[model samples]
Target chain A: MSFDVDIEVRRGDRTISCAFKSPRGITVLFGPSGAGKTSVLEALAGIVKPERGHIAVAGRTLFDADQGIDLAPEKRGCGYVFQDSRLFPHRSVRANLLYGWRLQPAERRLIAPELAIGFLGIGHLLDRMPRSLSGGEAQRVAIGRALLSGPQFILMDEPLASLDASRRAEILTLIERIRDELGLPIAYVSHERGEVDRLADTIVPIGLPD
Target chain B: MILSEVEWQIVALSLKVSAVAIFGALPISFVLAWVLARKHFAGKVLLDALVHLPLVVPPVVTGWLLLIVFGNNGPAGRWLEQTFGLQFMFRWTGAALAAAIMALPLMVRAMRLSIEAVDRKLEIAARTLGAGPWRTFFEITLPLAFPGVLAGMVLGFARSIGEFGATITFVSNIPGETRTLPLAIYAALQMPGNEADATRLAVVSVVLSLLALIVSETLARRSMRERGGHVL
Candidate 1:
């Protein structure tokens, strides 16, 4: 199993829960709008404090209610691709890609900067600031930045939801390549059934709790 | 009009005092601004009000308050002098300290506005990509907030250069020591036939202020362009 997670998160008056032990490759979290799908990823990434439960990524305990062990988000080793592509606007594309990679010990860097940039097809944007890029280009850089950081897994939160269909397809293909070639586990969030069908090795349904 | 040696010395002293006050307060202002911008606590409102007190209260009152705390006979003052061999009584350093206190409000406000404008989600994203809290702040948060920091420094400089009430009350108008531009202007105006000296000094003050504002605006625009941030 790539992920073994059973968690509950409280937002306002509502509580959201998900319990899933996902297989290798991508685990699709399928739900409608406001279904708290992103909250589940937040829990897995250690961004949201779970009300109670355990999150184990590849058998490493990220959080456990009974054991009282909760890792900081930085130590959780998650490469989160936010819905809005949170690139460091102050940085050039190449600098953004290297931000985390440089922080990692040379021995801990699993992916080469060149390889990640090449894979994401962002080589041409190395010197350009983020604002000059189109939405699709920016998203690609965001992904590459996370990938180059050498995270143990990736959490993608509706990465294609903002793009046009054609741009969506282009990124979808690139994501598929990341899944097949990089061999990193991914927990992908999406409401579209087509995305779930195309990406899920295991489908985890997330929604507001009763 | 060309400045005499004494006039030049006065200008230099004023610049030095203002520079020390602003630069000395920069890091402390950043921490206070970050706390006020990002933290939550029961006494948050009280802290905010306290930070702004120097701005609201009469500068002479602030100087009096400083005297109570940092006077040579006072606890902090005695400890600082005994431990570090430093004294702020009747010295230019005292003037700098007064100016710093007076300038602090504008500095913190400018920095807080910039920090509040930073998209906090980016910090979260940085953490998810393996950046620890310090790295995320220095790299992501600070860079995005640089323009505001620069603006704050300039505002503090202006305020410090013009700080008279607190400085005079705290350090006294000692020539070649605490007699900065404002104090010098006051001294010039006190004597008969010294109106020319006062006018020239006033002109220098205006030119310095104009230069600071121009430099601040140019740097801010450049930093904003480099950030190119639409998220802000």
Candidate 2:
């Protein structure tokens, strides 16, 4: 029900290191741009391997340098919603959502596609292509796609950065509803403090490395 | 319309040989293109250069190399002749093999460029959604790069149809067997008072090549549009 991370990552000249435990709630990593906030989530999601340290979600060790254990992103079972919503342009909305769900083991499938579609209010968009969707609609689909993958925890990296103010507000409300209704742990990365205040159950401040 | 019955037979044989060559080379070309596009390993440069050698070398040289490696006296040719009873020298199959070898570089180049153009981010996204490497490639990379694949296939087909030097050098100009359109055209030009037959074959070649180009262009544009990409 919690994620524990202690890792150090080096990107060229800069080094990023942090250790924190996120309980069963929305934990927001608030920082300025270029503070490596997204990198932290990427490390947790097994997209970027850490230079050193360990990551565990729900007591499962995803990465441990001492043990020489580093699970692939697919095996880590952590859902990631990128800022750009990286939906497959060649696939319809339903196909994109089912891309992960179809691969999940029957016993491990915690969230059904229907439930995800219902939760995200994207049922009507099932047949449409990702390119035709609005920014907000695409992001919602991205969120639903993540949820349907049966992830142990969700990592969202500035998921609403590309949306307008109105769409942003609408998505924020949807996120709140998801957190309250589904009770899924989320590690949200954002530079905006207002968003952290509204959604974060625990806030981890990130800043430029000394 | 000016083509005689024998000339039409040559045309049909040419089409059949080139079609076989294209389809035969496609799967191998795709695998090679993917390796060239996505993988980095020792000897990669050497492998790439080898794959592209037919493009820069003289077609006669390529044909000579094929003859050296796949001729009746060669190990592979001997083994195939003994084990499989398949001979490539002076055969229609030899013509197809020559055409495929000559056209492979174009197919690989087109497929590699297309594969490279696919967004890596989409692949990473697929991985996060629990798709294994094979699944990601088939479901995401292949579909996204399909337009380029089609373009490559057309280019290969066009090249196979026009293959001359390698085919003639490897298979020799055996009428009704190894003599394709280009060889037939050459044969007509060599005989006295057969200039009209050669001109007819030339026109047919030009029209077929033009049709292939148009079809490739249309397919490429349609693929781009289907993926919501702006047509350039």
Candidate 3:
């Protein structure tokens, strides 16, 4: 599914103006710390209300200022994985993965818990609590939690930022396996060119003057 | 026989009063905690102060305020009497109301801490997971705040069990009507040769407070353990 986003957002004193309408694939948003790449993902997911412009995902109007429409993040069906995994500390790994499925209106949750557990290679860790997992393990679980919801497009905000270099290398392969093998559309945020070059089907470079 | 009867009476009365107080204030505490922890409206500090008024204000003053709002011929009191054949002044219900008011601050404080501690990212994750605002609260925010909610309940229960000043002012120490444990203890102490009864009741109060505190601490520790393990 193709998506379109044309918006301008202000982060502190800096203003970011993005105008892009790309065909659906793995679109990597490359930028430095202050380049407002995460801001773009947030805008798409209906987290940060934009100052101006509209976002249309798969022909559906997710945000339109002139039309007085701004869908809530949940309703937009855009999954987001934070830099820090942000797993529910109160829940076990199984519970965290099943949280989204349980919230689904019975019929909407197409993926079963066993399927999700297998896909994330976390079947062995299902009964384990989030606290017991390694950083890479937690991110893998976080990804499983997000994918279980069966979102239209996934937004990953520097998912590997918290891991060690070796861990990053390992998780990068996992992310690619999820994207390429699963055939899921992704909007990945990263400052590392190597990660972008390896996984990205289309690059939307940010941070530099444009 | 008389001492055992009085002990049972105090136990039953204290339990009843605390239950009613907790039931009355829990929903209000949830809403107020969310507003205080999440919302950024104008005069938020004032709203927070108003919710926590009971903590700073004397229980006697809280009792007096309850009397003013729920006494005979008072607006809420008159409306309730007319609409539901209810009477708060000089009644058990009034003692409950007083206890609830007294305990509200503790409950709100506990709930606010829990709500504030919820990861904003998790809530955002739930939203993207196709859970709406209300769904997100029940499925994500509330569960994540479970440890806090339980702690709040214990705080409210402890506060309510010991409530005396407000109970005395609003409902008085009517035996078997509104004479909760604290009230019973106070009446026992005032009478000639009832020191033993007062002491027994005081010990019971201590036991209950200790139990509540222990449970609260356990829950707090479990929550910390869960979150701490997740951290890098």
Q: Please, what is the whole-model Cα lDDT of each candidate in the order they appear? A: 0.90, 0.89, 0.83
Give one digit per residue, the lDDT tens place, for model 3 in A1-210. Answer: 456888988777777888777686778888888889988989999988889999988788999988999999878877678888878777789888877767667565546778767777789998888888999889989988887776767789999988998988877887887676656678899999888898788888887555
lDDT of 1 at B63: 89
Docking verdict class for candidate 2: medium
RMSD of each: 1.9, 2.1, 3.0
lDDT of 2 by residue, B1-232 (tens): 7778988899899999999999999999999999999999999999999999999999999888889888999888889899999999999999999999989999999999988988999999999999888888888888888888888899999999999999999999999999998999899999999888889999999999999999999988877767853221
Which is the winner by lDDT between candidate 2 and candidate 3? 2
Candidates ranked by lDDT, best first? 1, 2, 3
Model 1 segments beyond 4 Å from truth? B229-232
Which candidate, 1 or 3, has the higher TM-score?
1
Provide DockQ values for all models, in the order shown: 0.82, 0.77, 0.63
Error of 2 at B203 (Å): 2.6
Tell me the tens digit of each residue's lDDT in model 1 across B58-176: 99999888887888987888999999998898888889999999999999999999999999999998998888899888888888888888899999999898889998888889999
Residues B1-232 of candidate 3 have per-residue lDDT tens digits of 2449757977898898889989989999988988999999999999999988998898889888888889988899999999999999988888888889888888888888888877788887778877888888887788778778788989999999999998999999898889998888889889899888888888888988999889888867876786541110
Candidate 1 lDDT over A16-87, as tens digits, reads 878999879999999888999998999999898999999999889999999999999999888899899998
Show where candidate 3 strays beyond 4 Å: A102-116, A208-210, B222-232
- As for candidate 3, its clashing pairs are A74-B127
DockQ winner between candidates 1 and 2: 1
